[model samples]
Target: MKKVILLSMVTLAMISCNKETQAVEKVKTAYIDTSKLLEENNEAKDIEEKYKVKSEEMGRELRAEASRFQNEAASFQQNAMAKGQAWAQAKGAELQKREQELGMKQQAMLQTLQQESGKEMDSLVKRIKDYVKDYGKKNGYDYIYGTGDAATVLYAKEAYDITTTISKELNDKYKGSEKKEEAPKEEAKK
Candidate 1:
């Protein structure tokens, strides 16, 4: 009778252990391709387009200023012989000063662009991280890893890739948020 009870208890213990193992195995894990997420992400694209336009505008402004300076330089060169050494030297010095000022302005504009872009990119990263955190919470995922060229995760099953799923969700959410922003402006215009 003791042998029978011992066997039953061992069987029960084995079954319970198996159940616990299955429970542990059920932990949800997935990964997103960070590069793909950034590339395909609508918010990221919008930010890029905005910067592209701003860069173009700045380029045009710089070009116009350069053209004006070039015309002055050409005029100075043409009249340098007639204007005498003193006049030519003074004009050259003025042109050099103007060139230096323009160079400084260009540097300032570029620095401003870089600083703004860095801050914006940082904000975008935070936003993405927050979105991912919310997504993990909502989906009951134990882990949602990020992978890319700078891969945090080396290997994961293709079946466990949530890149497409989460990217679509993020884009959809961005679109909805964009509409809300536009609605306020439209109402304000009224």
Candidate 2:
């Protein structure tokens, strides 16, 4: 009887340990190809398009200013020969000043466009990260790694990639919000 009781207790302890081991939950992990996500996302595409249009507009403005400056310089050159030396010297200085001003304006416009584009891109990245965090939490993911230019994940199975899934969800959310925004405008018109 003592031998049987002792054996039973040991068996019970082993079973308990086995049960605890079996109860351990697996860690759910996924990876996103951040470059793919950005490339595929509609909002990101729109932002790129917006910046492209703005850059083109700014480029046209700069070209127009440059054309005006060239015309003015040409006019000064024609009149410089007929005008006295002193007048020519002063006009030359004025033209030089205008050229410098145009260069500065071009630099300023480029910097402004770059700054604006950077800000928008940064904001979009933040939104994507927040969305991923929320998605991971909702979907019971323990970790979501990113693989891109500066890849955090060097190697992951294709099955573990959540980039396409996240992109689709993000684009859907963006489309829904766009509809909501348009609805408000439509109502305002009425």
Candidate 3:
């Protein structure tokens, strides 16, 4: 009876160990190249283009204002001697005030652009993270790591890299959304 009990316990232990090993092997994992994902994602590209256009427009406006200020300064320099010391002093003070105001506007514009861009980028990153989380859940991925810049994974097999797959999916989703948005505008026009 003692021999039979001991043999039974040994077999049960082996069976449990085999099941645990199989469970570990069944876990699915993947890694995404963070930089590549952003580079390839259509929405990210659109955001970049949108900001670029905004920056250029703001730059042109600022440049035009600066050019006007420059013209005024040039005019003052040409007429300062004829205008007399008191007039020159007053005009010089006024120009200095204008320059300071221009400087403040430039600084404020830069700060606002940076803040807006940062907020949009942060939101985009959050969306990407949520998408990845949902993707993992749907696809039965036990873990998904990020690799690039601030990499979370040091090395992974090429087979395990899902950057391209995710990028393509994201691009397709973005295109679908663009079409949907355009459809509404088209209807509005009709």
Candidate 4:
């Protein structure tokens, strides 16, 4: 009879502890629109502008090079009739080699630009992800979902949407960095 009573008490204690644990367990969830964050991110805009300028510069260089090649070809064609067949053939071969080289150079330039842009974008994503992870950890969020047109999160309460909060935080951080960057320049101008 004592053994039965002890077993009942132990069971009751275990159930109470479980109930307390359940009461303490809270799942905090939030969601952010990743596309909106990227759009509002000043650093991303600056990077985009830098790449755009670079691409335009590259395009101009390529166009100039192509124009030079076309001029050379026109001159070669004009001189070929008077220069004789062998000389013309040799010149044609040289022009072909030059054209091939130009093609390869253009390809290389495009690939390099693509690589640089990709690296910058990847770095930006990593930075954002790190920031988000830290934000989640600091804010005690159990899960922070990302939603956009792609919509990783299909439905969530408006109160649980933290996109504006995070976007403001990131923008403020970016603005602070920009101010810090300008401070040195301002001091130098002094």
lDDT of each: 0.93, 0.92, 0.95, 0.92
lDDT of 4 at 164: 87
In model 1, the clashing pairs are: none
For each of the candidates, the C-alpha root-mean-square deviation to the true structure, in angstroms, is: 3.5, 4.4, 3.0, 4.5
Write model 2 residue lDDT over 79-157, tens digit each, in one string: 9889979999998999899899999998998899889989999999999999999999999999999999979988998
| Candidate with more favorable, higher lDDT: 2 or 4 | 2
Backbone clashes in model 2, listed as residue pairs: none
lDDT of 4: 0.92
Residue runs of model 1 more than 4 Å from their true location after superposition: 1-24
Per-residue lDDT of candidate 1, residues 39-103 (tens digit): 99998898888888888899899989999999999999999999899999999999999999999
Measured by lDDT, the strongest candidate is 3
Report how far off residue 68 is in candidate 3 (Å): 0.8
Best by TM-score: 3
What are the per-residue Cα lDDT tens digits for candidate 4 across 4-87? 999999999999999988866688889989999889888889889998999999989989988999999999999999999999
Q: Which stretches of candidate 2 lie over 4 Å from their true place?
A: 1-25
Better of 1 and 3 by TM-score: 3
Cα deviation in Å at residue 185, candidate 1? 2.2
